[model samples]
Target: MRVRVLRVLDVGGLPRVFWWVWVSTLVARTGAFVAPFLSYYLTRSLGHSAAFAGFVAALNAGGAAVSAVVGGVLADRVGRRGTLLGALVASAVTLVALGSVHSVGLIAVLAFLAGLANNATRPATGAIIADIVPSGDRGRAYALNYWAINLGFAVAMLSAGAVASHGYSLLFMGDAIANVGCAVVVFFTVPETRPTSVGVAGAGHAGQPERAGTLVDVLRDRIFLGFLGAVLVGAVIYSQAQTVQPIMMGQDGLGPGAYGAVAALNGILIGVLQLPMTSWMRRYTHGSVLAASSFLMGAGFAVPLLISAVGHPMGVYAGSVVVWTIAEIGSTPPQMALGADLAPAHLRGRYQGMSTLAWSVAGIVGPLVGGWALTAIGASAVLWASLLLGAAGVPAWVMLDRRSRTRVATLRAAEAHWEPVLSAIASPEVVSAGVPTSEPEPEPV
Candidate 1:
């Protein structure tokens, strides 16, 4: 039993730098107390309406959307390490400042800035994972990193209520400290993953030199854009738990502690079940897994409608959380892998940034609409809408899957285009970091 557990948890074969990145992600996510609770803080602490809270949360996500473009461009132009480090430091400063202020205008402005600074690190982080982990294990590597994120979230959720009870100052301060920890890890341990010489990093077919991509170039990709559209749909469904769940629970007479417990359940279930679920899901194609996840998430979000009939709020909420967490696990790894599979190495940062942008856009839309619906229309209405929205994406995913076989092959070849570049440029300071760089080598059968 112990051996089985070890086998499931072990990550010894990946590059050492990946561990540093994992550590940074773990430390950072463990302190993700602010964003999740921001809506609660607005309603309960600051005496704002749920609609206003949604607006602010949407505004924050808007900042993330803008940063997605800038951060991706910077990651490619400037370098991943520097962009990540600068973003983290800025995030820490912005988080602290946002926590210190009291004015409504200041809160909105700072929330936007905080979103920009905090989320700008994502493209760099995803690009780094793409850079270091071998091709065959990329899916599993992403799953492992996601596990670390959920594990940390579970830890944070466990203490968020207790800490918030002490004061939200402590919550923001703790979150800032965690950002600093992430920066320290990155500055010392995680090396630059983007190739210094553009020619060495992303040489193309027939000895042709590849050019740097513009946002236009990335947008020109119709298939990828369609995939992003699909991503936007799922992200909207996921964001409801953040934006509307608190308000729903609050109206139902559940406090922050109850919400925290419910949120914590999501993290715990994901931390425990993500890997095994991801492992089991390997047999399925990405389209099918994502399609099923969509339905599950829709069902999970709609479960809150059963509140009055169920009579046990926490039990119903916990059950809902379990369903949603499973949906999250099913969707995340494949989504990450497919995103990686679709982009060229040269535009990885931009591609990841665009992926993040989809989520950010969803963040803006989900809360803006969900919060309004919760306050104006009804919570049941908002949730039911999410189910329909999720269902709309199934055909899109299925169509994309049918078209993706050729694109994936092209992508694999593109990545292989970087192998000689990676081998030639490898060093302690440069990219690749000793992990196998290409997807051509078949995994052991």
Candidate 2:
């Protein structure tokens, strides 16, 4: 049992840089009190209506979506280390400024700026992980990062309620302080890892020069576009937990306490199980894992329909939460690793940014759609709708996985075809330099 526990905690092969990144991520997320309580602060403390608070929230999400793409471009252009430092520092300033503001307009503006800065860091961080960690270990690295995030969130959620009771200013100040600390950590520890280009003419096909492409270039990649679509669908399906589930439960006679308990259970399960499950899932292809996760999430959400037949058994709801939480644990790390794997060395930041964009877009669209569906067709239909969406996404992800495999195979074939020509070009220079000719090393399997 002790050995098994040790195995789960083992993160030995990943780079030292990743551990520091994980630490900073944990610190930042743990102190994230402002965003969670932003709606409450507007509605209760500032005496704004819930509708206004929601509008401000929507602005934040929209800013995040735009900033993610912009940040990705900046990370590739300026450097990951600098971009991350800028994002953290900007977020800290915004958070501090947000506390001092009383006008709803100013508060909303600061919230959007804060969201932009905070979300901008995500793609840069992801790109850095891909830059530093070996391809084979990326899944584990991302899993460990995800685990840290959930752990921080668990801590933050617990402390947020207590902090809110004190004042919204304290929450904003605390969050700002944490962001500053994260910035300091990155400034000191994380170095720039962006690949340097040798120039288009000098570098051959195998060693193509790294260059930042326009957003149109990213949009043109059909495989990536398909993957993004699948991700957007999955996010919308999973999002029902936040927007629709509680309402349904409340309508069925469940209290806030019951809903909070289930939500907490989801967080706890992911925090505890994500790393171990990620390690175990390394043996499977991304497609299989994603398909299974999508189906599980859909099935879990669909279980609410069974509640009507079961005479409103709470056990059915609880069981569904468990299933979906497990699915969450299974899906995140593999999906991130796959994104990194599919990205070119130069385009990693952009690819990750695009992936983040899918989630951000879903954050905006999902609640609106789910809320509308809930009112228009009722809860049961909404749940079934979520299930159908998940089912549709499974095939898209499966196709993405197949495309990724095909691309890897094509690259390998190209490398094999170019080997002899490269050797022929180099042989005369080698002879002139008095170096003995030998077989070239084989490419990584």
C-alpha lDDT of all candidate models, in order: 0.80, 0.78
Model 1, residue 176: distance off in Å is 2.5
Model 2, 147-184: lDDT tens per residue? 98889988999998888787789999999889899887
Give the C-alpha lDDT of model 1. 0.80
Question: Which residues of candidate 1, in runs, are more than 4 Å off?
Answer: 1-6, 10-12, 37-58, 102-106, 161-168, 196-206, 246-257, 304-314, 374-380, 420-445
Q: What tens digits encode model 1's per-residue C-alpha lDDT throughout 1-445? A: 8777756765546676777889999999999999988988888988989988878887787889999988887887777777899999999998898889878999999999999999999899988888766566677778888998888887887789899999988888999999999998887777666743334435446366545666777899998998999888899899988769788888888898899788878777876787777777877888888888888888888888898787887788788888888889988878887887787776778899999889888877787788878889987888898788778778878888888879888767766766555434334444234332322211111
lDDT of 2: 0.78
**Number of the top-ranking candidate, with TM-score as the measure:** 2
Error of 2 at 105 (Å): 1.5
Clashes of each: 0, 0
